[model samples]
Target: MKEQDTVDLFVIGGGVNGAGIARDAAGRGLSVILCEKDDLGEGTSSRSGKLVHGGLRYLEYYEFRLVREALIEREVLMNAAPHIIWPLRFVLPHSPDDRPAWLVRLGLFLYDHLGGRKKLPGTRTLDLQRAPEGAPILNKYSRAFEYSDCWVDDARLVVLNAIDAAARGATVLTRTPCISARRENGAWSVTTRNERTGETREFRAKVLVNAAGPWVNDVIQRVAGSTSSRNVRLVKGSHIVVPKFWEGANAYLVQNHDKRVIFINPYEGDKALIGTTDVAYEGEAGQVSADEAEIEYLMSAVNRYFKEKLRREDVLSAFSGVRPLFDDGQGNPSAVTRDYVFDIDENDGAPLLNVFGGKITTFRELAERGLGKLRTFFPEMGKDWTHSTPLPGGDMENADFESFQAKVKAEYPWMPRSLLQHYTRLYGTRLSRIVGEATSVDGLGRHFGGDLYEAEVRYLMDQEWATTAEDVLWRRTKHRLHLTEAQQAEFATWFSAEMREAA
Candidate 1:
């Protein structure tokens, strides 16, 4: 944390990949420093589809290696962090007008048998008329396919990895951007300035990692003063949230006329998440927003199969994110690969590792492989260990979240079911850190409405580098969706006035 300290590794991003690398490197006995220009996951890492799947559609592009690795990593992540990730069933309604029945069946067959399958159920045919999953679907789709995938709290996953990295002896600097990095004396001279306090610091590191999601190319050209043949294409994906119109915990996937698929997922308890129009984006990653055309496209796709039509009034919220896909020269943005590529510039004695495209489902593995690329630099660093290690709060036995829930209920009997569920789902074993021997609702301190309390707020500020209310409400937890606009504004005012250090 000093101004001119020497470290083994210095990472230049705070997204999931960078956080994962920091955690891995720290556990392997490397002195690491991870600096972020904003709050953790305040970028593409947060605005993801929130699913850990094998990319069933990638099969059409013949990305067998990517699919197989992702499929294998799905269960690995589920085991490492069960609190924020759990199994979910996806119901895909068949349409003879789109893809042939045999092709769909063959794709599902490969999805079932492609990677080692053990924890989740295999695909099965469903009678649309009899199965409850198809009750809201139109009768034209008589048959459906039910497959397995995992749901993730994308922002929380990023924060947890950063937390674990910090706990493993890595310095995490939020709201601090690396302004300059130069290679001198076979080391990296990195200088960072704090955006909040106008404080500056410098460090000498043995290696530099450019895991700056959307800004990878920018870092190469501007920050590092280095050039690379590799590049990333920004693909904009948009999603809309609406009231839950269908029953059951299962989600629905419908194929659009353009051959792209849309997911209708149960979200925030009483709402549905439908998304993703893949369009080539040239705008800023931070300024991305769901356009009217993208929103209309999502609704239209949902209406194609669902009997309950979705109008503009039903849309509660909408968000958009740009994917930093590795440019494969494909004209269609949807056809681009999600696989990651690495470029190592070992010129002039120092090394700069540039990470290209990657998806959330393969972040941990990506980190492992990223570290493997630096094996020559740190020969004495520890071997791979994240495979079985539990992240900060994901230490449940057998990763049984249901069993953990029962235990929590018995322990915090005084807590309401809704509040308990929220805390347990977000914090897991770390719930006690916030609860801290309090009894009853009043003991949790002033309620900010909808399970938002002073205790949780203080915990996030102290531990998770939460400087603003948006970090807590929108990113750390979805309290913004549950709380009214007035409540949110009041919380923001209270947070700013009461929390003087943050200001």
Candidate 2:
């Protein structure tokens, strides 16, 4: 393995936490190398509720610190990537049969004042018959409460972090899995195998960080040949995407009979993204899927609240992700702590930091704290700086996407409105790089239906680590959802040919 590349820190996993840590550490002037077994955020990170909120439900469990940190992070993340993360209002219709009104009100009040909320609006009471937000709810619900949270393009957030890290002089390797690691002469020797070319490479690092979300134990025990007292419990959560049934951009949160709340959010432009059931999972994390019972349970919860009923046929797609929660000896999976814990083992002079649990909303703060834990080892490292910095393509002035969209429209007056909006929303300040010198649609090359064109695919390949059609279609961009099956097949054929030609 060519005498192994030496770095100050080595991170395993390409999920949000891993990417965030890489960006943070790289910005702090530390040499970093991050390797992911598959595409960035192909794991549980992309398959999240896609919200950057304080987790209102956690208030009941008295997780004051966790909630407060996450609450503050919501605005921090929003400013970091205004194009992808924006404020969203959730309407929770009051149901007397469920939790009492006073309890819900108290929870909302605490949520309002718990963290230092600056940009987002606080909760407000709503009368069902008068307010527009309550129009979609069933007649039985007479009152509701609306509160603020931020929605995120979870997959893009991870990719953007990686981009930012690489820009700050960090080495990033996707589709590369860590084969093994061993401590040697006050340092650690790690070897990774590239899945694409079947090539093995080695690295020497002073510290190793394991941010593998669902595969935390696998990396610790099998890959690193180390042991820890901490353990991770795999809890599977599933989401089903269906046709939109309500008006307005607001999302609905209904409390189920089992004391769990389900979110029905407006997704993509004309679809609804409803999720997520909590079930103890004992199988392989990669094999987790949404079962019929889970689908029925979710549909029933939505049907009980909305006037427009949803059926089995309405489900357009479904996805599942396993939460690698720190096992706190809790029997109920729902009651399990979403807070993260670090198990730093410095037995053989070198250090191994194993992150057990974390949520998408708290990844940034978790990264900052994770780096802080390693401060004693590397006192020469730079100070914290990611909270105020913008992610790749998120350099809009004042983080105002609306004004940025207007500027894009004015610049690309010849482009179609839909295409302009798509590019502006996804790329923000970086749109010019993608749409360079193109004054007409023909300049974008072949069109594959919808808003996808050859120019965009080429941009993803040249800039992003989009090696396969699925990588571009599913992760880097959600073109699969909008393209027809035949169009997708054609695009795949073209993409494969282009890759072979490049090779």
Candidate 3:
């Protein structure tokens, strides 16, 4: 191994938790490297329900610490990346058959006060018969409750963390898997193979962080050749996207007969994203998909409350991801805790920190706390600072997204409103970097489809570590949902040729 390749830390995942930890450690002046087997957030991080909420149902499980921590993190994350994380109101229709109104009210009350509620409004009792938000609900539900939570672009959140980590002097390697890691002479000898180039790299690190999400155990046993008393439970959650059925910005949460909750949220400007059935899964996390039975289950859940019924044909797309919850001897998958657990195994003075379960909302805090556990080893590292810092492209004045949009519009009056909004929503303060000196849509170079132009593609390739067509279409942005099949194929062909030429 080359002496120059030695570092203080090596993180083995590109999901939210892993990326967040790399960013935190790098910002604290630690030498860091983050490796991902696939694209950033190609796993559970991107497939989430996309809500930065303090799981209200967890209240029934008495997970107060997790709920409170997540609630507090909502505002903290919004301030960090206001463009992608913003407050959203959810309307819950009263269904007396599922639970009593008082129980629901009590849960809302705890949600409102638990995290030092500020910026977001408190809960309100709604008269569904009279309110505009109730227009789409069936008249049988005459009452509702409205509360606040935040929505996030999940995949982008992971990418932005990686970007920030790189900016802070962290080496980030995507499409690279840690092939082997072993404790030798009180240090970790790690080896990774780049899938695209078929190149192998070696490194020596003082500490190893295994934030591999669904593959946590794989890294522990297979890669590091170590064992842990802790185990990970794989739980599959799926979501379906369809055309917008309702006319409001607020989302709807309905209680199911199985004592679970379903979220119907507005998505990608004229689409509705509904989802999430929790089933204990034993299959490979990478090969998981929404089956017919799961799809029918989701459709039935949505049809129970909305006036516009959802049919099989209405689903435009469906995706599934597996959550690696820490096995706590829970019988029901839904009852599994979303809280994170860290197990540090010091094998002959070399430490391997294996991160178990964590949701997106608390990733920053999780990173901070994870690093805190390693303070005795690196006491000279910098103190916690991510709490008040703004992420890249999120440094708008006071984190005001609307004001930033107005500024971008003033700067580029010739840009179409739809495309401008797309740029601002995804890039925030970095819109100018993507638009450059382009005076009109024609200046943006080739138009793939919808709002996707060649300039944005180049920016993604140059700055965001995007390589494949799928990386740009699905994760970096949701252009896949807007473009036709032929347009997609054409874009893929063009992108491959351009990448080959650049290489």
What 10-residue stretch in candidate 1 is worst by lDDT?
A: 494-503
How much is the lDDT of residue 243 in candidate 3? 96
Q: Which portions of model 1 miss their true places by more than 4 Å?
A: 501-503
Off by over 4 Å in 2: none
The sequence of per-residue lDDT tens digits that candidate 3 reaches over residues 247-335 is: 87999999888979999999998998888989999999999999988888888988888898989999999999999999999999999
Q: How would you encode candidate 1's per-residue C-alpha lDDT over 351-421 as one tens digit per residue?
A: 99999999999999999999999999999999999999998789999999999999999998999999999
Per-candidate TM-score against the hidden true structure: 0.99, 0.98, 0.99
What's model 2's overall lDDT?
Answer: 0.91
For model 2, the run of ten residues with the poorest summed lDDT: 1-10
Worst 10 residues of 3 by lDDT: 1-10
Residue 250, model 1, lDDT: 94
The alpha-carbon RMSD values of the candidates against the true structure, listed in the order shown, are 1.0, 1.0, 0.9
